[model samples]
Target chain A: MSNQEILNKLRDTIVTQDIKGCEAAAKEALEADISAFDAINGGLAVGMKIIGDKYELGELYLPHIMMSAKAMDGAMGILTPELEKDKTTESIGTAITFVQQGDIHEIGHRLVSIMLSVNGFNIVDLGVDVPDETIIDEIKKLNGSKVLLAGSALMTTSMQGQKDTMEAIEKEGLRDSVKIMFGGAPISQKWIEEIGADATAKNAADAARIVLKLMD
Target chain B: MTNRMTPPERMMAVMTGQKPDRVPVVPFVLGYASKVTGISLGDFYADGDKCFEAQFASMRLHGYEQTPMYGYASMGAFEFGGEIEYPYGKGQGAPFVKKHPVETIEDIEKLEVPDFKKELPGAYKQADRLASRCSELGLPVSVQVGSTFTAASVIANTSEFVSWLIMEPKAAHSLLDKVCNMFINAIDYFAEKYGAENMLPFDGGPSESNTMISADMFAEFAYPYMKRIHTHLKELGVNSVLMHPCSDQNKNIPHYIKLRNEIGWSGKYVWLFGPETPVKTQVEAFGDHDIVCGNINPSLFITEPYEELLEICGQNILEGMNSPSGFILAAGCEFPPNAAPIKLMAMLDAAEKYGRYE
Candidate 1:
């Protein structure tokens, strides 16, 4: 099959969450002279974008978005080493993911991580129940071109943690360097703007695009 | 003037937006019940009789106004043939899809509309037993119906379900429709058997979680199905249709209020907001449409001291009472099984102390 066809096949496999198919397609694309960068962008990245669009447009739901991320990761498992071997890659973007302290909802943040990783962004997953200091410390460590500070909380009391984390970033003089995106059971655009966040997506796909735009 | 009522009677009154003796306290007490009955969480799920006994025992012990039957995680997938594994002592866990039964459009074509009588008699029988027990105890029984998207998520596997929404909208809708129909049937059977006056169809859709999809998506996918269920329950003589959507669902409360208004169920339906939801904002948004229930952090029951629990319960009841429309004190979600029983009792005590109606 042609390289473009291989890229197209990889996209389909990832979109469909065909884990085995994605891995095989990734290998075939690599063998058929497809550049790792193109394979990552045209194949995995494009498929994720389609998933995101569908998610935003109300076509895709959470479980499917999650599987698509898994599928992308499956393909990435095969392509990551190739890109590292070539050592000729460009940065897509960078994101910081975490479930703020007192909020133990990570399924959403995990999806954001997968979407960002597949889209070629560096992700520093701070893990669940993360404190403000920990998030700031991670941001200092990664120091990516743009920071995607995210939080998820399933309860109202923990909503303050999101506000507190963003406040800490601003207090630490790191607010300008970072772009905040918040989503969870309770977060809203009003709350995001109220807490001084840069942006808030309704779901993970919008989150991915919002982070990319913030980076741009 | 109406005579003052006890906390239980007051709670029932408040649920209908009447002047209760004061604000009623109905702590979400699934785990609290298990602990009260000394039944292991494993026994609660594995044996329906034990689960009902524990549930009734917990409610009676705490003087709880409502009993939340069924785990939030179980409802979403169980009806769709998903396999569930309960870890007993551990909290409720999500049901995993052992088989995708619907792999393609042809598979969808072959899919049969689930016959609740044939398929869910065991569950309904359990519900019947619980309802009977609750009736004997002169308490109310509330059964949970899995939320459409969350249910779909479990059946399709979270990622696959979301992906299918985007990749296969028609198929997703078809699948959701089937699940909705099955739940409606199950709810109707339980309502009829249990008496509609005793039924509360708790739609466990986590649309408010903000993790699943956008408000627009919820308006399309989650809200309509909920409306249908609510409408059907109302028609079946169920006076109250309480929705238990977990998450910071502040944005969606208005939508729920609108649904209640459109369905002419304004005073009858109760919007059970999760503790993660911004209560003040939601109360303000809901503003007299339907009764507002909950926002007590469930974790507090397990973590907080009895005094602290009373203070929070007292404060929430006071706040709700201050409103033109009254409130029902409830946990954000199901009360964790390990929650200190004393704390739940303290909540009841606080309601009795401060929830006195003039």
Candidate 2:
């Protein structure tokens, strides 16, 4: 397949959640001498954007979105080493992801991580149920460089942890050095304002785009 | 001169939109039961008899009107071949993803209708056993059907599930349909053997959390299944349909009320439980169309002193029983296993002191 044809096929396979088709197309794209960046940008990322749009419009559901992400991850796994062979890189900023203390809902954080990683951002995953002090400690370790400090809480009761994390960062004089983003089932724009979050997104795709905007 | 009613009688009166001597206290006591009955979490989940004994013991000890019947976080997902990890502590348990079980489009196409007999006979047997026990004890039993999105999270991982909703819309719908159908079948089987009059309470924990998806996604995914499930339960003669979605479900209250109306459940027959939804909101939105069961934060169980607990319970009774009916005092979610026994006693005492009707 031509490079363009391969990328299009890969995108289609991801949209349909054809895991095998996505893997095959990814390999074919690699063989066609397409750069890793082009394969990701022209094929996977763009396809995911379209899928996300349809989902928001009620054209998609959870299982389908999950399948598409798996397919994209599969294709990305094949392209990462090859992409590293070439030294060209895009600097899309950095994001630190964690689930708030007393909350173990990592699904949102995982989705946000996948979306940001595939869309050309550096992701530092802090895993699930991380404490506020730990987040603050991590931020201080990163010095004064601006990074997206994103937290997710699946429980309404646990959302307080997000607020506490922000407070801890502010106490450490690191709040201004980081931009905070919050999302989860209980999180809302009102919650963002209440918690003093720098930004909030309805879903993972929006989160990535918002983080990019904040970084820029 | 008047006599005091039993916990169940007091609760039933409140449920039926009639004056009770005082407000009934029905705290969510799942883990508390586990602690009281000396039953391990694994056994409580695997055997319905043990669960029944444990729940009944806990309720009897605490003088609660209701007993929490679901065990572990992943019982609903286990019916769909999901694996759950039970952590040994008072902390919330974790669910680990061993595999997707369905990966390719062909896998989706070849999806088998989950056979309860073959797949997870334990779940059905347990439900039946619990129902029988509830009948014998003359105590109402509530069965939990997990939220659609929450169930999907266990089987395919939450991130993967949300991504699929975005990237593979068709496949997502297909999976959701299958999950919903399985849940309906499970509920039908249980209701048939246990009697449809039994309360069918759904535990849609993550969906209500609202941190994972938007209100729009909830309307599209969680609401439809809830309507179908509630409708099915009502058809089986289960008039009371209680939804326990553990987060702030304030945004979706209107949708829940609409579902109740569609199911033909009267105001007194519908119950919505969550931590963030205040009793005032329930009264405002449904207007006695349903009972607002809970908003007592589980944290209070651990944090509050005995006297303070009683005071808070009394205050909640005053605030929640605005209509003198259509209100139940319950923990927002399952009470933490480690809650002070004295706190529960204080709640029951408050009910006794203030719940009596002349």
Best by lDDT: 2
Q: Lowest-lDDT window of 10 residues in candidate 1 chain B?
A: B89-98
**DockQ of each candidate, alpha-carbon based:** 0.15, 0.14
Candidate 2 local lDDT, B49-142, one digit each (tens): 8778998888788777775565444544556555444434223333333455555545656655576555444265666677678777666666
For model 1, the superposed segments whose C-alpha errors exceed 4 Å read A1-71, A74-78, A84-106, A112-216, B1-4, B89-107, B119-122, B352-354
Two-chain DockQ for model 1: 0.15
What value does the lDDT take at residue A120 in candidate 2? 76
Q: For candidate 1, lDDT tens digit of each residue in A1-216? A: 888899899888867878788889999988888878899889888888888788677566565677777777777777888888886666665677887665544577787787777666877788866777788888887674655666666444456567678778888888777777877655666677777887777667777767777778
Regions more than 4 Å wrong, model 2: A1-104, A111-216, B71-73, B89-100, B103-105, B116-122, B199-203, B266-270, B307-311, B349-358
Looking at chain B only, the TM-scores across the models are 0.87, 0.89
- Docking class for candidate 1: incorrect
Model 2, docking class: incorrect
Candidate 2, residue B50: how far the Cα is off, in Å: 2.2
lDDT, model 2: 0.69
